[model samples]
Target: MYPDIPIRDWTFENVSGGTTGEPVKFRHSGKFFETDQGAKLLFDEWSGRKIGDYQIRLWGSERDIVSGKKDWMNKIYRWMRNEVFLNTFVMSEDVIKKYINVINETKPKMILAYVQSIMEIVKYANLNHIEMYSPRGIMTSAGTLDEQMLEEIQKVFKCPVFNRYGSREMGDMACSCNKNEGLHINTFVSYIEVLDGNYESCNLDEEGQLIVSLLSDYSMPIIRYAIGDRGALSSKTCTCGRGLPMLKCVTGRIIDFFKTMDGRIVYGDYFTHLFYPCTNVKQFQVIQDAIDHILVKLVFFDKDVDNKGFYFEKENEIKKAMGEGTKVDFKIVDDIPVSKSGKRIYTICQI
Candidate 1:
């Protein structure tokens, strides 16, 4: 899936999210990181933070934390870069409290984290009326941030919350400027296109699959690579006045598509939208176990809150979308596990 560059010439190997299926590895040249720095520089300039600023990263899982502790070279590298790493996979009350204490003590200038991970922290802090350290800025990636999530995060952090769009295959493809209008494409590192089902370019503000061509990865030329997520290109220029183009929004992963019995495709966002108005649901995951069967696992904030009628209505909606023959089952669980990369896979198709 890449160029004929020798393995010895590659500088880094990264894996895909593997949320829908098996993860694929991609190799990068030395210049890849050099050009990736351009995105960081842009973000720093936009957010009023520098490269050497003290930053805390809420990322990875418990296993990653254990392995990271043994990697002394990495520790030294992070120290030199003025960075701290905190495990965000498990957000138990104790773990959240520990993270809160560390952030207060370290007082990092910036906090970088996955949208869901930081939202968990925000939820905990808000519930306990806990005071959090006010960082200069917060950067969120890996997951989408709805309006509610963004507002809560800003309220708690009292800092600009910047949303970044990217993948392991492509480094920082785009990021929101201080204006927070939309994500500005990292034109220095990538060229982006939003194409419809016909493999033709989508009009401005038209939602379609995003294809990216990496400008700096000469070792493995990834051209017009479909990154699987759906989004749209924007015609409106950002108020920040950056010449870089903008993406209106990233809808969801293309792999989230579920095939119905009659050969129709149901986007996973359909299931996610069902839970949007459900305030009692703390977390949820939808899985297409087979062509005609869907399993919904949910964690509720209040177990005693009876939502049988709500569940039945949602089941009917799912059946309407996936075909009436489709079997929709709901399961209540204590928690849902995050992916190895510490991201919540909201939907999965096991076909």
Candidate 2:
């Protein structure tokens, strides 16, 4: 820590990759935002959202919009871009009603949101018979977006949903194009390398830890830093004709993997893929309390629906994947809490 460096000298305030572990705070060159903005403009343009296009961002906190008088600068920025910022902290019926009203009226071109937050909005609209405004496309980040969740979001919004991948420390790394073949790497800002346990390049689609080198950060040089996530790079190119490289998948954090009693390591996606076909389930989380005991927390669309049979099936399914020695307990909840960074960690390992 450089205690002698004045706080004013450091330009950007950024937090470390804490989706899987503890968070660390750091400062960087003031020019970092400019570089990120340039990268984002390109990413958004690829998805049909131009710089001047009206957009809605579902990313601000309640304090940011509590009173227009309190944050005059944000209000002016919103006005200039014709954007709306929905609060993720409060999604009560009253709050959602206000969001629906504003969205229907503005009719923005794009809706950028955290995956789970947007899913919750769409779920509420479906459950309460609330009408939604149609945007050119929806872009989601900050959490994992499985196939089932993607289908539900697109079905409710009636628009193409693009998945964006990145972190606070790495800025915009990859995003899906119109083709949706896979996420294209932002080779302009960062150099990404995928390596196996032996630290060798994985062939084609083999899963490995993502080591990123930030080319833009000169004030605080970061080279081949493990951002604490698992993914794979595609040897194939995109069909959309973009020369940008592709990523096969960005599964959840590597630390979330659970070790079974039999010493088998199970990744988080193994549990995520299981609930993909369950339309009745809104969201779920898995916590490995011990080697032989697992706790499953679930949020359903309909609270009254009979999940007894479904639980029985899931028990057997989980047992098969995690080994029959593990016992799983299911608990239905109203909501799943997010981390301090406003992202959801679907899998929690107590071991």
Candidate No. with top TM-score:
2
Q: What's every prediction's RMSD, in angstroms?
A: 3.9, 4.3
* Model 1: per-residue Cα lDDT at residue 37: 69
What TM-score against the true fold does each predicted structure earn? Answer: 0.85, 0.86
Residues 19-130, candidate 1, lDDT per residue (tens digit)?
5567788888888888886777677667667878999989854433555546786677688778888988876668888999999999988988988789778877776788
Regions of candidate 1 where Cα sits further than 4 Å from its true position? 1-8, 61-70, 257-280, 290-293, 301-327, 349-351
**Model 1 clashes, total count:** 0
Superposed model 2: Cα runs more than 4 Å off: 1-9, 60-80, 93-98, 128-131, 276-283, 299-306
lDDT of 2 by residue, 1-351 (tens): 733534345565667755555777766775666788888888778767888898888863343456546488668867876677877764555776778787789898999898867876786788778778889989998777777788888888888999999887878999988888889998888888999989998887888999998876656767898887888899889999988899988876876788888788898777877874576877789899888998999988679988889999999988987898888999999877766565666788888
TM-score of 2: 0.86
Per-residue lDDT value at 97 in model 1 = 86
